[model samples]
Structures are given as C-alpha cells and as structure tokens.
Target: MGLLRKAARAMLSLSLATRPAVADTEIDKHSVDVAATARAFAQAAPLAIGDSYDYAPGVQGEADAEGRIGDTDFKLRLFGAWDAQDEERRYADIRQASLHWRHDRLSLGAGVGTFFWGVSESINVVNVLNQADLRQAVDSKEKMGQTFVSLGLRFGNGELSLFYLPTFREREFPERPAFGLPVSQRALFETPDKGGDIALRGLFYAGDLEAGLGYFKGTRRSPLLIRRSPTATEWTPFYIETENLLLDALYLLHEATLKLEAKTGRELDQGFFAANVGIEYPVYSLPGGIQELSLIAEYLVDDRGERAETLGQNDLFIGLRTSFGDIGNSSFRGVVSYDFDSQGNYLDLGLEHRLSDYFRFETRALVFLNAGRDDNWLYPVRNEDFIEFKLHYSF
Candidate 1:
C-alpha cells in the first residue's frame, strides 16, 4: 500500500503540471484531503484470526426454483433458469469494505474497496439506482486516499448530504441498444466518476399520512463540470447524467408498502425532470402472516427540448407489489405497468421461500411485451426474461 501511494503521487505530479492553468479552479486543498482518505481505507483489514495472515479470498453464489405456485411475492412464473443473464455474470465480484458510522440522527460513510454498481440499460433504468463504486476512485488498493467520503445529516424529517456518487439512471448503447441493457451487478462504474452537490429535503405530516419534498443542485456545483447540455434526438441522443442539477420531490403516504418490491421503466438523463409519488394501504390481516398490499407510480417528463438523442416524450407508469405475514413478509409479489401513446406493457413476478434457518431461495421473472407499436421514441419492447436464486448468509 505504501508503495502504491508513492507511485500515485509521482503520477499525479506529472499529470497536474500539464493541465491548463486555472489557479482559481485548482484543486489543492480538496485534493490533499481526498488523497488522505484513500490511504486510510487501503491499509489491510484486521481479521479475528491473527495478524500473521498474508492473503485472503472468498466466493458468492445463488440458486433457485419455481413452479408457478405463489407463496408471498409472485403470482406466476413461466420457468426459472440458472446462469440467467439477469442473475449471474462472468466476473463475479470478490471483496468489499466501507468506513460507515451512524449515531443518533447523523450519519457518515465512505467505501474504499471494490463492490457493486447497479445496471443502467433500458429495462433496468426504472429499477436500478446508485449503489457503490469504490474501485472507480482508487489507483490501486495500496494507494492511500484512493476513496471518497459521503456525509449525510438528518434534522428532524429534513436532511442534507454530499458525496462523489455515480448514478447510471438511464443508458443507451449506441450499438445494439435493444439488449435488456446487460449489466453485471459486480462491476463498478468507469473511473474518474462524478459526485452530487448541496441537497436539502424536508418532511411533514398531512392528515393521517407522511410525506416530503427535496431538491439538489445535481451537478450545478461540481468543480469538474461547467455546463450540462443533453440532446434527446435520434441522430445525436441527449444523455443527461441523472447526476446533473435539477429538482426532485416526493410525497409517499406510508401504510401497506411493507415487504413489497415494485418496478417501473423509463429514461431520465439530461433535461428530463423525473418525479415519484406513492402511498400504501393495508388490505387484510391473518395469523401466521398478515395479507398487505401497496400501490406505486412514477413519471419522467422532458418537454420539447433540443433534439440530440431521443424524442422528448413524457413517460408515465404505475406498478404494485405485496406480501403477507405477521411481519409483513410474504412469499409472493406481482407487478403490472402500462405506457401510453408510445409502447407496450410490463409484468413482473417474484417469490421467496425459506429452505431452512440457514438457507433460503427467491425466484423472479419479468416480461416486457410489445410496448411500443411504432417506437418513434425508441421505447424498447421484447419478450425479455430474468430469474433469481439468492442464498443469503447472516451473522
């Protein structure tokens, strides 16, 4: 680790001298702190065994089964497949680490090891949000100060936060853009990634419900970026980083959203201002498990704008997922959503089972039928399939 730091500093010195000089825009103090943070996380992790350990290794895997019989989360499943494109990939990730602390209402965390970065393709845009990407910040595990910090705070129902986070909300592959956006859960976003800016959020109670509103500069204050120009046209393609400056507000009336996972699909990069609002209502109650359900919906609207990539059409859809049990955890989940004036419809089902106290399995499948008849806006449509067999380990 020490050697890597020396090499990185040597490399940075040479690179910094070549950049066009903008003293006012220089990153002197910030760079120093970033370097320090990276170094601190790379030092070897202490194991309970002993201090004499040299090398360490581990593996992760999942397997599942389904027969259209629903228990808690799925209504129906045609078939389940192992090594499915959606579940497992070639290069499964190895190790991960994070220096996170949460006490009272204040929280601070930063990761320094390689881990998971969610997908960004067509079908996944609505479901996948930002996760973690430590490898993108490091020159190597040995390079100290190779990671980034995320500081978050909560004052009552309101909160403030900042960090160099990567969010691949919407993506379009120039070549073969129709693929269910094959993304490996194990890979990190490309290096030299970007971060978010000053964000403020507040909460309140209305009648018998809870809700909130929030906004952030997105990237308005980012030092490395000066302007945001997203073009939504067929010839060019306006790609908004989803990390840009914009306003996002939500008011979720909480009730029966327990143990439920829903999905929606659309694009929201660049000038697209996306917003989501939701409320859940409990329908029934039982003995072993309580039968509960919730409804949800979200939208992304991009008014007439520059034509650089895709058509500036509004995308609106709604979905629902429900589970049953005394703890609000059921073995079944069902979802259905529709798109208007553009493409087709979507249906997704999921089921979970407890094989034993130490073993469990989950099954999931999704179908994206012909949603777009003409597809002038490139609304993707195909009989896409996915399944998951997850085995979890608890301490």
Candidate 2:
C-alpha cells in the first residue's frame, strides 16, 4: 500500500506540475482540439438460421482529449461497448490514458496505453504486449488497453525501449454459440500479481531496410487450456475438462524482424519456433492515380508441425489490397489462407467506404473451405461462415 500510494502521488505531481505550462503554451499557439468518436453496428448472416449461429449486435463509444503543454503531450481516451450476445460482452475500458514527456533523446510515458510492434498482414506473431479483444474482432487487430510505464532512448541510429507492465489482462473470447469456443466449458484464467511483466525492444532503420529485436518476460496474454479431469466430458465429447481448466503460462519470448516484413519468434518452454516471411509490394497504379493495387504473400510455419492449435503449423497466405484515393477514401482487401498439413483453407474479404465526413460504411466476410476434423482449431468454426456490415459515425 505504501508503494502504491507513493506511485500515485508521483503521477499526480507530475501531471499537476505540467498542466499549467501546457495550457499556457496551447493558448498562445491556438492549437487545441478535443472531440469524441463512436461506432455502432448490427451483424447477421445471409443464410438461414442454424443451431450454431446467433444474431450478434454491438455498439462502441469513445471520447478523446489531447493537448500539448510546452514539450509535454497528454492524451486520454475512454472506450465502452455493449453486446447483446451475452452478459460478459458489455464492458467499459480505458482505451488510452497517458502522458508523454519527450526530450532531445529520451521519451517517457505512463498510465494505460496501447501499442503494436509487428509487421504482418494476416497475423501478428511479434506483437504480444496487449491482449486481443476477440469479442470485438477475431482478426487480432483490436487490442485491449494495458497499463504500463515506458522509457525510450535514442542512440546513434537505433532506439531502445523498456516497459514495465504492472498488471496483466486476459484475452476476451466470444460466446460458445458464436464462431469461437463454446461457452458451456469456459476457460479459467490464472491472474497475475502486480508488476508481473517486463519488456525490452530495440529498433533500427537504414534506407529501405528496417529491423527490430525484442524480449519479453511475463505472464502470457493467451491462456492454455488444461483438462481438469482425465474423463470429464461435459465441455465436449472430443476433449476432457476440469473445474480449473484455464492456465496462464509464464514465458520468455525472443523475436526478430527483417526487411520484406519477415517476422520470427520463439517462446521458451513452448518447444517451437514460428516464422512469417512475407513481402508487400505495390503491383500497379490506376489511371490518374485514383486507385492503386498491392500484392501480398507470406509463408507461415510453426515448428510444432501439425499439433499446434489456433495457428496452422504450415500455411500460406496471399492477399491483395486496393485503395481508391478519392474523396470517399474507399478501400478493399482480401486474403486467402491455406494449411498444407490439414488441407484446410479460409478466405477473408473486407471493404470500407466513407459516406460523409462524419459517417463510414464497412463490411467483411469469412469463409471456410475443406475444413474437417483433422483441422486443429478451425474445425469447430468451419460451419460458421458469416458476413458482417457496420455503419460508423464520428464527430
């Protein structure tokens, strides 16, 4: 309690000391902006209803406040959402609430924040800082906010960052009736103590080539399921379950990135290494520079071979992205992924267009093909193909 109180006092003092200076500078510069952004949507399927499908509806609201005071910058964003699918779907969270102080070669940040540190189109193997909010999206693009203190220093042509995460958050999953795991046998998370994780990363860029190396030691954001009993079968006939089935495994991760957006990483004690080697290059441009098309290809591999869940042990992902550089700022992206070991494949398509300055429209579809019992993680969701549309309004 004493340490926590001291930390709180320090944070409060830091904020108070810089508040007035920032306000005066902003008033002089006449550059202050505060606003709110929000999105609401309803999701359904075009096919007839089935025992495994449910109509999911949700809405998200957020407010952001940002300003600069002299050499310090502060931003606070509050996010909340509600989903009609289940009771656990409704949540209120701090998306980003942080103060950033910068010097000539040093930068410091504190409070809850979010950051991504990977270079992959289909998956992010090196980004392990924040847990995914899977209920919002299964693509792993959306992440929950993490509270931490960060320090970054620039030396020569490289930058080094150190982070201290004071708490750990678990990944969010959708209800069983949805496309993910069943809710009947929910996972039991092993919560961690305060200040349970530390991370370090160094990044360097040279000409057209860039590279990064990172190390993380802490409780895993993803949980591993363990059977409570050898013969328990209430969760599913294929697998056993226990009362305390969710186990949070502690791990050390070492990752590296190279040019062409290649990423490789290994988890200590996991006995496997994973790699995503890919390149994203623009194919051509349309006439008058109104549109552009880009090609993407990546080979994914896991040393665990065919026994891995979630990610296929050996796979290929090919995608195309088209951007309409018009007033509406429309874009379309699609990807097809195939697993060599199980002969399973999936397709993902997404489209987005702006209706007005304050409104936008988006749609996405996920389709599974040739998925069978041999597939590790995709077999349960093979029959859950669906399309989703959303209209977003921001101001």
Candidate 3:
C-alpha cells in the first residue's frame, strides 16, 4: 500500500508539471483523499463450500485525486482489498483514471472511467457500462473502470453524449462459492476480444421533471454461465452481444419524488424487458430539528421471470432511512425486498456514525428468508446470512 501511494503521487506530480499553466486558472488546486477500512464478518451459518468458516476478516484502501490545469480536469482513483480466507477476494482496481476538457458547449474525455445510468434504487436495469465487482458485495454498486472515449454537446434544455468503448472488463468473482453455486471457470466471449461497444444518451430537464433516453450496443456486462460438459460441475462465463434501449425519469412533487427506470433488450437470440418504479418521501426536522425520516418503496418486474439471472424479478423493495442530526452525524437504514411469487425475501439493516474528524464506524446485517425456495435467487446461498462491521480512517 505504501508503494502504491508513492507511485500514484509520482504520476500525479509528473502530469501536473507537464500541463500548461493558465494565468486566471488555479493550476495548483490539487487534492488527494485516502481512506483505509477494516472489516470483519460473523456468519449465522457456515458456508456451503470451502472451509465452512463462521468468521472472516478483510481490509481495503482507497485513494482519489482530483485536479485541474487550465480548462482541462483530471481524476485518478485506486482501490484494493485483501481477504485472509479467500484468495479471489483479494484484488485491486483502477476505478478511474480519466481526463476531460470542455469549451463552450462541447466536451471531450478519454481514459478509464466509470459510468452509471438509471433512477430506481432496487434495480438499475439500464446500467450496463462497467463490469460488476461481485467480490465486493452483492448490492451491485461497486464496478470496475472501463476504457473509453466520450463526446458531448450541450443544448438549451438538455445534453447529448456519445461513448465509444474500445475495451471490456471481465467481471470479478470470488474463489469461494456463496449462493450455492460452483466456482466458475475462465470466461468465454462470443464477440471479438477488442470489444467495440457504443452508447448514446440524451438527458433533458423540464421544470420538476428530468428524463433520459439511452441506447447501447455492446458485449453484455453480465455473462451467461454454461456448463463445460454434460457431466461436468464447473461453469464458464459466456459474454454475449446485446442491443438495449433504456429510459429513466424522475419527477419531484412536494416532498416526494417519483423514479422510474425501464429497459428492453435482445441478448444473443433472446428478447427481454424489465422495469422498476419507485417513490421516496422525506420528512425533515422530525420531532423538531433532532432527526429526519425517509420512506421509500419500489416494484421490480422482469419479463423473463424465473429465467432471469439477477434479483428483483417480481419483487417489492421497501426501505426506511433515519438521520439523527447530531454532532456525530449518525444514521440508520433498513430495507426489505420481498419476492411476490416465490415468497422469498431479504432484509438488510445498517447503522453508521462518525467517531471523529478522521474516523468512522458502520455495521450491517443481512438476512435471507425462504432462501431454499426453488424459484428464489437466494436459494444458492440459503445459509449465507451474516453481519459485518467496518471501521474507517480517512487522511
């Protein structure tokens, strides 16, 4: 980690020194934020495979640097994690190393970056830019950076952006099986190695309404696992070409917000559609300036139903978040996702509070109910419920 930090600082210094300075611009305005976190987990039940451990521990470090030279801005971010129990869980990623320049209404950028699309919290059907970092968590929030070139033009009420991705990143997986599944073998791509994916997006704002339309033609970020042989137990990831159209919108009403995200696409020879609609309402200064409460609900639907590889198919997600306005800046969140047909559900509880200027702590518990049901995605890890604690320090 020390070497990594030094190398990143050296690279940033070299880049800044080579850039042309501007008289009116703050060329020396550069800052780096680094954080180190340690985590420990306590499993309610033993894992179905491997050592069947009831406890595990891990540590991770992250660094983000941002700066500007004249009219161009640059950013660099790095992350790495280590796990004692699973070798595959120990990995590193250059989540972002990109540069952008803008003049008038035109903007251009190139390098490794992360792009996210969608409005719903439960399921982001339209987010297909970067590969998932499954080793980090199952929430699908963490992603690997993608190499690409992007161009954008701003309009009076909206903007149009085009992305040309010249490369693809394979999804990350852990060595130990979690959801009652076998460890997959190497990945196999149906398209050429030099993935030439393209995406175009248009976003418009009208008063309280915001909407976006997007299209993508590229190698799918999620893979279809196929058995190696009829009798083999191993599976291999097969990346397929896909063409997808996506729509997302948000409307603000009083203290409530409406969110919707939908996608229709063709992968290989199969056609599918998925949609998610959600609403969030927040009450500020609950009981007079001590706390705030937010209510959230969302419904997810997928045409593929049982055949869908992801979660949130015919499911309802309900969440409650509470913020205690105090010096420590404490917060509490609870979410439940219930599958309508399979009678399966998931529960997550999280709490976090700041300890000091440079330290913070968080704890989360995940519970799977009716996970053994045949039609439930959690059937793979019926006994994988666990609680995790994390401590973080920022510098």
TM-score for all predictions?
0.48, 0.78, 0.88
The clash count for each model shown is 36, 4, 3
- Model 2 clashes, total count: 4
Clashes of 3: 3
Rank list by lDDT: 3, 2, 1
From the highest TM-score down, the ranking of the candidates is 3, 2, 1
Residue lDDT tens for model 2, 202-289 = 8876654556777776665654544457764323211211111111111112222222223333343344466667767775535654
lDDT (10s digit) by residue, model 1, range 1-395: 44234334433443343332333232211100000010111122232112312122222332222121111110111111122121221222212223334557766544332221111111221221232211221101111122334566777645665544322222212111122232222222223233332333344444543333333333221011112224311222222323323222223335433121112222233244332323334455434554555454544343422221222134454555566555544567665545555555555566766555555555555555455645433343242223333444422
Worst lDDT window (10 residues) for model 1? Answer: 30-39
Which whole-number lDDT from 0 to 100 does residue 49 have in model 2? 22
User: Which is the better candidate, 1 or 3, if ranked by lDDT?
Assistant: 3
Root-mean-square deviation of candidate 1: 17.3
Candidate 2: minimum summed lDDT over ten consecutive residues — where? 240-249
Q: Model 2 Cα RMSD, Å?
A: 7.5
For model 1, the stretches where C-alpha displacement exceeds 4 angstroms are 1-88, 92-96, 101-108, 112-147, 154-157, 165-271, 285-290, 295-320, 325-329, 376-383, 390-395
lDDT of 2 at 257: 24
